[model samples]
Target: MARPIWTGVLSFGLVSIPVGLYTATSAHTLRFHQLQRGTSDRIRNRRVNERTGEEVELDDIVKGFDAGDAYVLVEPDELDEIAPGRSKALEINGFVDLDAIDPIFFDRTYYLGPKSKDYAKVYALLERALAKSNRAGVATFVMRGREYLVALKSEEGILTLHTLHWADEIRDPREEVPDLPGSRVSAGAKEMRMAEQLIDTLAMDWDPEEFHDTYRDKVADLIKAKQAGETVEKAEPAAEATNVIDLTEALRASVERARAKGKQSKGKQSKGEQSKGEERKQRTGEQSRQGKGGKQGRTGRRQGRKESGLSELTKAELYERASAAGIPGRSGMKRDELIKALEQAGRQAA
Candidate 1:
């Protein structure tokens, strides 16, 4: 089981509920580490003094403020004293309507659950009350020695806390965007009606699971293929941007494309749902007929191999094939290291 990173009491009105905070999301992207090119040695960073051309130790480092043209160095302990909080507690100052809070303020989200069995009832009560009132508890908390504005809302019968950005952090759009001089109004009622129709036809319920990071998937596939000792080919350059002249014609074409895409998506979704249902029925039927004996033992392995086979093969394939020949974590290796590893593995196999 995943453990909560933080343990604290959530304060609102006269009530305080002890809760544990768990991260609600995580990144799944591949990471790379720096290394020396020729020796396959991991590279290490150093804090260096620019003037002396020498590495500085951690203890020598101090917080500095620019006073005119001079740097005023402050001790670590002194710096900590001036920081937002020595004690980390979410001090909720006021309650606000969830809708009233601007979407721009939200930063990161955390799941807040009862820290102990005793707090469960109060937690549930707070969640239900927030749900019924359509209000979120506004709170202040200190994290990493800094004060943060947080919104506490009920999500699926559990309290979820979201860290908010300060008002000053949000940039004013008006500053960057120019005010239009009321000259670009050429769409007639018929065009407006057609646009609205197109929008309505393409609209669907928001399903987050339906969307994915396509770029991340492609990167993963590329990385995997490169690991397996394959030569990576250069991708085609992107199409150049073109200037549009006829707005009406463009709008018409866009509407047709949107409709076509919507229909295709709907058809795919229906087919997928049907396939899942059929699979479930087949599993049930097999269970009834052969008492678990009909189940395939290597189905998962076979499926994995099939998926790996069909995925795009890249230069990463060489690294992976090298790794299989006793190279470790070729995924973290550089292109040159991968090439060397692949060559060594090939020679050994020969």
Candidate 2:
């Protein structure tokens, strides 16, 4: 594991846990260095005095803030003299519901772990406490000479920390966005239903692996091809942004496309299963599996029933299936309602 960047004690009331903070993510972006065209020489940057047109040493640098007509220069030592006292520690202000913090306030995430083996127990205790209460500790700490507000909460078995933006940093959208909609435009009930259906057809669980930095990949490919002395050209159709002519028609088309994609996916999976079964049958003549065939057949029958539509299952069976599928509000759902909800969730999961 990489060494943590920050180490300190996490304080909650009278309890404290020795902890270390490690960055949770890294950039895989391509980097470039400046070079003159047709030359291999590199270009480097230098700090220069604009008035004197001379290079300045790092030690001579000082930060200045523009104050109307004149600039107010501040020395590094002077700035450090008044730095916040909480720079070396993370003291919890209080715990709040995780949902209470808006997503817009979140900036970056870090993983928190015990600094030593002896601290592991205390760390686990804090993790479980926050998780059970569905709360996160808001705290302040300094890193890289800058103070940050952060949330410390449990994710799975480990503690995760998220840096937050100050409230003043968030801008009001009403002031920035022009002619914001306040029911100026509306959709009919039929149109709304179609749109809802389209959304349901496309609804899916989160899977980060499905996304890629395609443009960056293309740039990397270009770099490689250039080094290998090759020319490449590719074209992809542009995507349509909006269709204002017929909202209902667009929603209907979108629903059909999503459903078609789902069908195609299932069709491919079915083909794969059939192919595997055929290969097994060809190799064994459907007889090498007879040792526990009776038990296997009974189990397969039970599995088949479980996989069947919700309508074919009893109330108890429906409840069990709903629970297994992680459906919300299942306890209050009637048999028919459970059947409909489970069917939709099953399709989405597939």
Give the top-scoring candidate (lDDT): 2
**Model 1 stretches astray by more than 4 angstroms:** 36-39, 57-60, 79-86, 178-186, 229-244, 264-350
All candidates: TM-score: 0.69, 0.74
How displaced is residue 71 in candidate 1, in Å? 3.3
How would you encode candidate 1's per-residue C-alpha lDDT over 1-350 as one tens digit per residue? 67988777777778888778899998867787898877778888889999998999999888888999999988867745775342445667877989999898999999998888998888889899999999998877766556778899988888899999998999887686787445675657766777787788778777443344646656766887889977655578996554445545666876899989878766755654454444444434543444433245345323333333312334454444444455655645555565555444433543
* Model 2 vs. true fold: TM: 0.74
Candidate 1 structure lDDT: 0.69
The local lDDT score (0 to 100) that residue 344 gets in candidate 2 is: 64
* Model 1, C-alpha of 156: deviation from truth (Å): 0.9
